[model samples]
Target: MAKRWTAQDVLDLARLYQPAGVLTAAAVLDVFSPLLAKPMTAEELAGRLSADPRATAILLDALTALKFLSKQDEEYSVPEDVAGLLAEQSADNVLPMVRHLANCLRRWAELPKVIQTGKCAETGLGFRGTDADRADFIGGMNTISRPVATGVIDKIRPLKFRHVVDVGGGAGTWTIALLRAVPRARATLFDLPAVIPIAGQQFAEAGLTDRVNLVGGDYYTDALPEGADLAWLGAICHQNSRRQNRDLFTRVHTALTDDGVIVIRDVIMDSSRTSPEAGALFAVNMLVATEAGGTYTFDEYREDLREAGFDEVILVHQDEFMNSLIRARKT
Candidate 1:
C-alpha cells in the first residue's frame, strides 16, 4: 500500500508561502534589519520593505496557517517553538532559502529536450545565465539542503568513515553538515567550475574552509575523484535517464575503494507507486520544470545501485515526508 500524507502535512506545506517568514527573521538580527518580535500591520511592514502589501499579507496568512504564527486581528507573530530560528539574523540566517523560492526559481517551464530525450545538463532546471538566477540558485540550494544535510550527518555517524565526496553538491551544505556532525571528518565537493566560486564563498561564510576541498568537474565526462571512505549523490539522480543514471553509478564504483559507501538522498516512491502522494506530485513537477528530472521509487533506485557494483542498498527514513536515504556499500 502507498503512504498518504496527513492533514498536518498539507498544513506544513502551506506555511512555506510566507514571503518574509525567513526574511523577517533574518532581518531581525541586523542592526539595520527590521524586527518581527510582535505583530505589525502588513501594509506598514510592506511599505518599509518596499514590497507589495497584498502579496505579503497572503504570505503571512500562509505562514499562520502552518502554525508558524498565531494571528489575532491583522497582526502575526512567530510561535515560541520557531522563535529561535526567527529571533536572530546573521550570515547564518536561512532567509536566503525562503527568498530564493519566492523570487527566483518560480518553477519555470520545463526544458524541451528533457521531455523529448530525458537528460539535463550539469545545470538542472536552467538558472545558469542571468545574475539574478545565479544568485537565486546558489542561495536556494544552500538553504534547501541545510536541513537535509543535517539529517544525513546524524544518520551516518554510526559508521566509521573519514572522508566524503559530495558529487554535484550545491554550495557544500552536505559537507558543512557532515563536518559539523563529525568534527574529525573532512569532505570534498565536486561541481561545475562556475558554481565552485559561489560554493567557496559559502564555505568561507560558514567558517568551514579548512575542512572542505572543492573540486570542479563534470560527473558524466570526467572521472569522479576517489579514495574517500564514503561519497554521496544528493538530489542529483533524478536529473538523468536510465542510461545516464547507470553511467553515474559505474563511475562511482570505479572511484570508490573496494568497500566504500555511497549514500543517496531523494524522494523515493513506495513500491505501489500509489503511496507517497508528495513524491508522485514532485515527479510531475519535475516534468513541468525540467526535461529529465524525476522522483524514483526505492526499488528503482536499488536496481541502479545494484547494477553498478553495490552488494546491498538500505533505505532510511529521514523524515515523515517522502524523503528517504539509500545507503549502498561497495563490498
Candidate 2:
C-alpha cells in the first residue's frame, strides 16, 4: 500500500532540506576539525576560520542542536561520536563523504532549473573550491566503499582470475578487495590521470602495489588496458546512458580474453523503477548531475550487454542500492 500523507507530514517532508543545509554548510566550513582540537567560543572559531562571527555563532548553535557538537558555557566542541566521523584526526573519518555531499547539495538545489531546461545543473565549488571537491569526491568513494568491499566480494568467493581490469576504479578500493580475495590475481587499475596517483597511494598502503598496474586514461575515449580475463565495473553504470553503457561494454568485450567475464556493481532497479526507493532517488541525482545518466533495470542491462557481444548475462544479486551485481561473459 502507498503511504497516506497528512498535512503535517507534507510540511515536514518539505522542510527536510533545512537540516541538510545546516550540515552541509558546517562541513564546507570545516567546523568539526577545529572543534576536535579543543572547545572554543564562536568568536574564536570564526576568527580561526576567517568567517563571519555572527554567522559562525548561528551555525555552531545549529550544529549543537543537531547533536553534532556539545556546548558548555560559551565554548563548543565536537561530540565524541560525531568527531569520529567528521574530525580529520580520526582513523575512521568520513569527513570526505560529508564534503562530497556538500557538493551534491549545491547541484540538487538547482533541480528546478534542471527540470525546466532538461539539462544538468551548473555546479559551483563551495567554500574550499575545485581541487578539494575533486579530492573529496574520490576520497568519499573510498570512505564509503572500502568497508563493504570485502563482504561484497565474499558473496562471490572462490573467485579465481589471472588478471582483472578495474574500470574507473576510484582509489583502488574494489581492486584492493578483489586482489586480496584472490591472492594470485593481478589487476590493472584504470581511471582518469588525476585519480591514478591517489589509487597508487592506496595500493601502496594496502601493500598490494607490486600486484597492481596503474593505468591512467579516460575509458570513454582511450582503449582499456587489455589482456585481462576479468573486468570489474563498480558503481559506474549509473553515470551513463544506455548507449554509453553499450559502447563501454563493447570496449570491455574487446579488451577481455575470449572467455573473460565482466562483473558490474551498481543499483539494479525493478521494472517499475520505483520499487527500490534509493535507486529511484538516485535517478533524480543523476538527473541533476549528468546530462544522460540514471539507474537502469536488469532487462536494460541484459539488452545492452547482448548488443555489446556479451552473452549469459545474469544478475547475481539484487541490492537496494549500489551493491547489486550483474555478470556477463564475452561471447
Candidate 3:
C-alpha cells in the first residue's frame, strides 16, 4: 500500500515558495546571526535587526515552523545544526548564496512573460550592479561551489596531473580543491580582471599562494595559459551557446600539451532531455539568467570535444547533484 496524492498536495506544491521566502527574508534581515549571540524575544530581535517587531515576530514564527529556528518562552534561536552555515560571521556562512537566490526570485517572477515571448527579461544577465553586489555574487558563488568542488575533485581524481589550468575559476575554490588533492601539482586560475584579485585572496587564505598563478582575462577573448597537463571547466558550459563552447574547447586544446586532458563538470541531461528533474529545472533557470545557455547531452559534448581536436571523449562520472564529469584527451 502507498499514500495517494490529493488536491491539497497540488496546492501545497504551488505554495512551496512560502517557506523559501521566509528563509530568504531571514537571510536578508541578518536574522540568524543575531540569534547566534542569544535567543531573544521578537521585540528585542526586531530592534537588533532594525525590522518591525510585529512583522519580525510573524517571520520568526514562520522560521520556527520550518525548523530553521527553535522558539521557546517567546524567544527565537537558530538550530545548532545550521547556525554555522547561516551566521554571517562564520567562515562556512552561506548567507551570500541565499541572498543571491533571493535576487533570482525577482528574475523568476518574469517567467510568464519570458515563456510567452521566448526571450529573457529586458535586463541582460551578466553580473550587473555596484561593487558590493558584485562582491556578494562572487562570494555567493564561492560558497555554493566549495562543496561541489570537493565532490568534483573526488570524481576527477587528478593525481596524475602535474599542472592544472582552471578556466573561469571563481575564487579558486575548485583549483584549491585540486591542488589539495594533488599536493605536488600547481594550478593557473584564469578569470575576469575583477575576479582575479578575489581568487588571489582565496589562494592566499588557503596558504597556496606559491602554488597558484592568478591570470586575469576573459576566456572568450584572451588565450589561456599553456603547458598545463589538465584543464578543468567547472560549471562553465551552461553559460554559453554551442558555438561558444566549441570555440572554448578549441582554445583549451591549444592551451594543453599533446597528451593533456580536458575535464568538464556540469549538469548533463539525458538523451531525452527530460530526466534528472534538477537539470530540467536548471535549463529554465538558464533561460531566465543567460542569453544562450542551457543544459546539454553527452552526444553534444562528444561532438564539441571532437571538433575541438580531442579524441576518446568519455563520461567519467555522473551524480544526481548535477555535477557530472566528462573527460577528453588531446592525442
Per-candidate clashes come to: 3, 0, 0
> RMSD (Cα, Å) of candidate 3?
2.9
Positional deviation of residue 156's Cα in model 3 after best superposition, in angstroms: 3.2
Tens digit of per-residue lDDT, candidate 2, span 83-139: 888888898998888888887888998999999999999876567777788789999
Alpha-carbon local distance difference test for all models: 0.69, 0.92, 0.87
Query: How well does model 3 score by local distance difference test?
Result: 0.87
TM-score of 1: 0.67
Report the C-alpha displacement of residue 43, candidate 3, in angstroms.
3.6
Residues 107-183 of candidate 3 have per-residue lDDT tens digits of 77788988898787564342334564567777998987887777677886646899999999988888999999999
How well is each residue in 1-331 modelled by candidate 1, as lDDT tens digits? 6569999999987665354444443232221224344567667657766778897677667667756666788876666555644444344555445445433223422335445655432333322235645665666677667766676567755756789888998777777877777789888899988789888997998899998899999997999988888888877887676678889988998988889999887777777764577777667656655566677778888888899988688886644343478899896
Q: Rank the candidates by lDDT, best first.
A: 2, 3, 1
Instruction: Evaluate candidate 2 by giving its C-alpha RMSD to the native, one decimal.
Output: 0.9
Per-residue lDDT of 284 in model 3:
89
Better of 1 and 3 by TM-score: 3
TM per candidate comes to 0.67, 0.98, 0.90
Off by over 4 Å in 1: 1-95, 103-129
Q: Quick one: best lDDT, which candidate?
A: 2
